[model samples]
Target: MKKLLILVLMLAAAFLIYRFAFKKKRAPREKPVPVAVSEQSAGFNQSMNSILSSYYRMTEGFVNWDTAAVGSAATGLETALKQLNVEELKKDTTIYQTALYPLELAKTNTATIAAGRDWTERRHALNDLSDNIRTLLLTIKYDQAPVYWQECPMAFGEGESGDWLSSKAEIINPYLGNKDPKYGKSMLNCGENKMTIDFTKRDSARLK
Candidate 1:
């Protein structure tokens, strides 16, 4: 009976030692944290959206060949551009440097469009403005809303072309610009959609 008791005690002690000494340690779990938007980035987005909104309105005016409306919209775009935080935008050094040229050109062309006497001249300026704005937007990824890049194959003349950004996927030719008053529907859909900028994915990448 004494020897049996000694063996039982030895077995129990061995089991406890193995359980404590040979057990594998568990890895600590990582908890996910919520993403927070910074004030500067939020302001930057607001400014960019405002610029895009004004540009869209200006494009609409061009489509209707309403010079007064176009001028007004251009003025609004100028204001929006002026309000943008350049220092904030400079956070992305690469984007800031690349965007500067286009941004300045957009400003100059918008001013010209606002003051131009001839409709054709204004349209020409508008084309340049559109290109510059498109480049700037693509570089910075201002908003999370999709903008369509549309191209008119016959904008300047046959075989000549121009492109503009639109809020919708549908093509509305600002280059044609209500040129045919007699045929109200003529040249309204003269362009093809070149690309759709889906900003949701793009803006996320920019944030990262």
Candidate 2:
């Protein structure tokens, strides 16, 4: 009976060691990462995004020197500009009135691009459009992402230069264009970053 009792105790100990100490462990479940989104800014951001999308397409057209593509994209950009959430600008009385001017100017520039007589005319209009768009963004306190303001020293001529806005800092000279038979791709990357416009909420400290 004593031997049997000791045998039973040893078996129970072995079972406990296998179940509690040496048992295969199950892998832990992973937690999902939370996505941050602001509903208040969604509409304004979307509207601005649409405008930039069309604007970038227009820039691409200019870079390729495709007149038809530029005209089409210019029309698209004008339409996008019209759909801007101007009401958002009304939140700040100071900028509310100031914002409309640049918006109108941008639209006008787009229209000019659409009806431009030649590549030179359209390119000039695009440069004006870029300036107006940048002003509008500054007036509206754009907070989505940084916009790179770039300048090409000899874009128009040896003594004339032009500025443009881009999402990336990398220079892609729309005025020079890759389609230039002589320069080919030599002048495509000719430009310097003038400034970076970033008004994200995290950068609110800058306003102070």
Candidate 3:
């Protein structure tokens, strides 16, 4: 009876050890929650749209070689850019930091363009401004409208290149501008469409 009792005690200890130590433990499964678009995001989108509108006008001014129009459009673009909520963006640290550089660059260049400088200087500034805006748009994935990235190969000279954004696929070369004093067409159809930003598709994927 004593031996049988000892055997039963050992078996119980082994079972307990197996159950506690050698058992396959289950990990807690994580469920993905959908991110609902907030009012703040919508507001941000509206602000970006306003900026884009001004930018489009500026680009058109350049295409027409209207210095007064370009300067006015640049001022408007600068104002719209200033109205953007940097604090709101800072809530997402990574994105905020990533976007800061381009935002600043665009703002600065817009101001420079608005200063009523010579065409060469303004064109250079516009080039930088366009590039920075492109970077910002791609990084933030602004959902207002589809932006077409267009590049002009002979923008600055024969070999140099520049890029600009447009709401439509059609290319109106802001770099070439008017050929003659009468605002005649120059290299108006100069560039090609490189990319298009459509955030709706990305948002749809996230919904799934």
lDDT of 3 by residue, 1-208 (tens): 9999999999999999999999998988765566545324877888888999999999999988898999899999999999988667877788889989999999999999999558878888988998899998877877666899899997888899988999999989898876534336757888899899766433344553
Please write out the lDDT profile of model 2 over residues 1-208, one tens digit for every residue: 9999999999999999999999988998765554433323788888998998899999999999898899899889988999997877676778879988999999999999999999889888888999999998887767777899999998788978888899998999999989876688799999899988887653333332
Candidate 1: where is the Cα deviation over 4 Å? 1-40, 179-184, 202-208
lDDT of each: 0.82, 0.86, 0.85
Per residue, candidate 1 scores C-alpha lDDT tens digits across 123-157 of 88988998898898788764557789999998887
Q: TM-scores of all models?
A: 0.74, 0.77, 0.75
Error of 3 at 116 (Å): 3.7
Pick the TM-score winner. 2
Best by lDDT: 2
Which one wins by lDDT: 1 or 2? 2
Quote the positional error of residue 166 for candidate 2 in Å: 0.8
